[model samples]
Target chain A: MAGERVQPATLSRSEAALVASEGKAPRTERGRKTLRAILDAAAIEFGEKGFHEGSISGITRRAGVALGSFYTYFDSKDAVFRALVRDMSDQVRDHVAPAIRAAPDQIAAERAGLSEFIAFVRGHKEIYRIIDEAEFVDPESFRLHYATTADRIAARLKAGAARGEIRADISDVHAWAIMGMNVFLGLRYGVWQDDVSPEAVADSIAEMLARGIGTK
Target chain B: MAGERVQPATLSRSEAALVASEGKAPRTERGRKTLRAILDAAAIEFGEKGFHEGSISGITRRAGVALGSFYTYFDSKDAVFRALVRDMSDQVRDHVAPAIRAAPDQIAAERAGLSEFIAFVRGHKEIYRIIDEAEFVDPESFRLHYATTADRIAARLKAGAARGEIRADISDVHAWAIMGMNVFLGLRYGVWQDDVSPEAVADSIAEMLARGIGTK
Candidate 1:
């Protein structure tokens, strides 16, 4: 059942392009920074007021960029919202990539990924709101975000299996299971409350992954 | 880190009462069936058009009930949406509870729960849209739904541990992890596609629970 083809992460260039509105891709370094500002401000606007109530002006005000700059990069509130969803998805991948890369093995890679993810989420609590809102605001983006994330995870796990660092039987089910564990764990430890540290959360998950949770 | 208290599922009567709008609880068997009809209709309405576009009239029309019947059970569209969120949550619990109760062990119980859950999602695909929309439309219900579900899972795991059917170290983390896995797996195999059987998905998870996925 695990024979499905897994795509490489480098194909994200097309994804980055998708993050920009039609005819709105930035050409210069300054334009890129302004686009970044608009997306960040959007995160706050939609995150706080939701999609219907959130306006382009609110994003521009928070971004401190002119209305013209906003229009130059985004067609409208909906466009920017879609862009923000993709951007947030990218932000999480970028934030967690280094830790995942630095880990010594597959299990440790997952641990580092979760720890870094929780830390990132704590700093960007608005992330959950933005991403969750995408489910209603832009269904396609919502679907794409999870689909790509799960695909990336499956690809990585498959590589680890080939290297003999992970169970050879690892498949999409394991990938989705790991992703789900990281997501809920992040929601509980990162967004809702912070009584526990990220390292501690990662440690518990690492132990669980190292051995089954059965009593036998 | 896993010492948090997990309340029992029986506390859901208070939750059900909380789901109803003020002065809208059904008092008779007929009223209860009417209320059930309204909720089922609301699921289709919201599921098809979303919260904003879904209307009481659409729901009443689908339910083949009178307009007064909707008002008899719900104060407004918002009230019914909130109620619907809780209703879906309860529907899932009631749907999965029997299988869980009939299992021979905690791990089997979990397997049964996931299998039943996926099957339920397949039949009630609207559930994802309605429950996810609650995050924006009715934030409290959304939080309550997840918090209650996680608490129930934790409580079950704790009971299983006491009975020597599960690892004693199980706690909120494990509960959340399991819930997360079941949810994503459902989204993938249940809502997104049906190429894989529910039994296959549940079996994979049951094996993972029985033994860790680590190469060693």
Candidate 2:
């Protein structure tokens, strides 16, 4: 998941938000903070109220920034929402990258990635609503989120195969399968309820991937 | 998914539609046919036009039924949409049940289910749009759709494990992982495009579930 993780290497919050924003990137530390604040606020706004009911004023107020400062980073509500989606997408990739990179094998890396992703969802419960809403709010962003995620997963699977860590015949099918598993698993265990620990869910799935569910 | 497939057994289209509709099931054969026509038209109306843009009158127009006939089955637009979601959910399960029941083992059953589901989606691309829009139009129906699907999957998995076809440690985690895999795989191979055959996608996933993705 890490080797093919979307976005450039070593991206900051400001940089990620900038990817979705139409405006120029902030120059100073304070400017970066404001942009970060706005993105986070947008996540909460859209997450709680959804895209249509969610307002730009609500985001600015939540960020504790003036409306003008909001405009400085994002041109309009749509711009900020798009930027927020990109920001959240990068946040997940970044959040799970280290654990994935540290894993001993491709299978272990995926386990680490899924475990980390679920844990991330538990903390940012709004992620599902935000990304799901983008399907109707910003169709392109929605596709880009899944498309890039799958691309990264496919990249790592290819790399894993190259290293003889996984099966040699990896393709988009497997990547999408894993991606969907992570998304829905996160929704069920992380957001909907936490009755099951992230490690438990990941461990079960990891076992399936390692030896499969079929009788030996 | 057959052994534990939700809804009553041997459900007709009218019965399936009745599960969602607040009104009573059509009493006569002619009434049932009218109800079926309304539901089919709703699919086309909501599928092509979406829930909000979709109108009750539009549905009646498409079905070639009178407005009174539409009101006879559903009270409001919301009712029809909710009914549509349930109908679609039942449709998918029923569509795939025969192949699943015929499979020799759990893995084969899942493969058969996915293969059939993709084939189903290819013909009913509007499924994603309608079911997804349910999240906003009717949150309960949206939750019910997925929750029930996952439950049915969990049931089949448990039975599969009992028969020594799959791993004994099957739980919600495994069920969700498989359900998620099928959903996304269907979206990619079924709705997004058909360059890859449903059988090929199912075969690849079946191989993964059978032998695992990690190098032996």
Candidate 3:
């Protein structure tokens, strides 16, 4: 529900590599492309119709994957879902982190981060709906989604505090508060409407944080 | 499901009175109690099962009223939902306004308002689940809720501006933002979990607004 795919599993890169290698060999690059297609179709189907309503046959039809090959890649529908969430979470983290690194200062970092986050959400709106529904399918995914991003932001805030840039006394609780607010607001305003651009909403939120409600 | 009671209608007071009065003798206090019991039962059933899962039979059973008597107060389940939302909205407003009025200063009024709002939600947590779920059942009810609360806070902000307590240029949009943030945060931290006291959460928010997030 935090706008991207998430997993509770803390698989290391090596473990992920081993799992990828162990998966049934789809002999050609074309076969690999088909796997990606299946994941994408599954995400849309699950998100729109929900877990209970989305059918494996419908998903295979949408992806143009052979029904037999679905078993080759995943143990079951749940496995496909777990894989999709992890992939999406990785994609989101990769998409947003570099933008933060590119900015020269705290304020600029926040601006870049917000803009990139908004752009990411706009670009992958469908996957977000799936992620939002993850709470019902597997609550741990939702909890991990918040925890991953909250931990990231909390780490940064802690670093800033150590450097004397942020208030020393501010708790990780407040960091989570900011993270939680931005997330829920993005879900409500970004995913659900076209009236306001995500970029504009992101800017407004960045402004609220960098300054706040009080007059400067 | 927000784990609270919510319904999908926005009935004005006169409309509610008209609906409640339908098919009931005016002198019958028993009728009034039966009507309230039906509404309360509806709230519980909706909260537990959501709009799609809740049935009129279940509601009447919970209310301990004859199944036929259900139609005496409401035309359908939807009507009952409308009445429930309207009733809760009025109850929340009634609970908050007097406390605000009795406070000694604007800050006190604000604090009182937040406390009363929290207390109201705590008191009616079950009913709140029904209202929150109504967001999906009917967007109009949610929209009416946002607009009503925004207008109230906007008026208060205007008063604060006139008294030179707040920045004059602050818009109703900001009022909406504050109202949205406070209410949602309360829902997340208060009703969702009791990890923090509602008063502390309100104080943190109130303090943030008053002093801003910058170095003092």
Candidate 4:
């Protein structure tokens, strides 16, 4: 049974005990949970107060973990934020990737991917703030991540163009442009709580992007 | 005569000495000059360190004025940044207005206005950054300004749609999208130091906008 998918009796006994203990006690399983708690706490603190002002002790206290436990996972506040951004990026990509891959055409892919990304941002506003606040923390990491993503998307666009799926003249810069606009708009509309429908905004973006600003 | 353009000989004689000997300087003239100095200093500081980290003391020191003097022109750091953003918006409007007004049609108007705006942003990267960075500094000011400008452009696009100057299906949201995308592109390529040619970026944006993303 242990060799198969069956849970070990000892592991289940520990899990039940840990679940029962909750905030009154801390076990090894609970300690691992504390790591995620710290990240969540840090995300909120960093998003609200910004990077320079956010403190590790504040995050640790919020997470109900000891200050020393924070150091076990992250060396510094910046380290915590970097890991947070990487994690958020992965989460976002996971949320949108299938939608992006499922589109029948390049245009459809962008539209569908953008819509999914918007929903992902709405679902994870704190993580989105962490990603944005990280910009002032480390511009290089922010720029590098953005550029790499843009390049990936641009490569896809280029492939589409080669196959006559998209406009041949579409440059990598426009791909970056599209990416930046999406990022900026999401930050403004979703996280910052601007008074605009995310779907309406995305539809506007997709339509204009599909047709362009030109009169012809 | 008091009504004459030329100053009285006696007044002219003292004015030169007044500029040099009046340690406090002339109030109106000196204040105007100091305001300009403070704005220039604020721009440099905000550009270098971004908004939140930038301080009035730092701006005053950069302007070579007393710290108290900084408060006389601007009520707060927020005030200064708001003024800075307003100033940039004014400069952008001035730079692009004539080209847009003179164009024979929507396409020509967009081409000329957009290109001029891009060239201006390329030449004055700091101003562009200050305006863009306003999103992080004061989302309210940023959105108000963007919406105001966007609405004006949107109105024109709506008029065009009504007149059949553009496709009837195009919405005012698309106008905002166009405005947003051009700015996004220019900032990313020209200001953010993304490795791309401004001309190529402009051309691609123009082409994509002119044509739809549809597989024609």
The candidates score, on chain A by TM-score, as follows 0.89, 0.90, 0.78, 0.73
Docking quality of model 1: it rates as: acceptable
Q: Highest DockQ among the candidates is held by which one?
A: 2
Error of 4 at A9 (Å): 26
Candidate 2, B138-212: lDDT as tens digits: 989888988999999999988887887767777888888988999999888988889999999999999888765
lDDT of each: 0.81, 0.82, 0.63, 0.64
Quality of model 2 by C-alpha lDDT:
0.82
Considering only N, C-alpha and C atoms within 3 Å, which residue pairs clash in candidate 1? Answer: none
Best prediction by TM-score:
2
Give the CAPRI class of candidate 4.
acceptable
Candidate 3 residue lDDT tens string, B1-216: 223435333334444465463554223555666776787777788867767789999999988999888877777877777667766667677778998889765555666787767766765666556665555455577567756877887788678767766555555445545665656555556555667776776666666555432222
DockQ of 4: 0.32
- Candidate 2 scores an iRMS of 2.4
True contacts kept of each: 0.63, 0.76, 0.08, 0.49
TM-score: model 1 vs. ground truth: 0.90
Which DockQ values do the candidates obtain, in the order shown? Answer: 0.48, 0.56, 0.22, 0.32
Runs in model 3 deviating more than 4 A are A1-35, A50-52, A73-93, A127-132, A135-137, A187-189, A192-200, A212-216, B1-15, B18-29, B78-94, B100-114, B123-132, B143-155, B172-176, B213-216
Write the residue-wise lDDT of candidate 4 on B82-192 in tens digits.
Answer: 777765676577678898789765555666666777777766777765776776787776877777777777676666556556666665556555676677677676667
Error of 2 at B60 (Å): 1.4
Model 3 chain A: lowest-lDDT 10 consecutive positions: A1-10
Residue A98 CA error for candidate 4 (Å)? 0.9
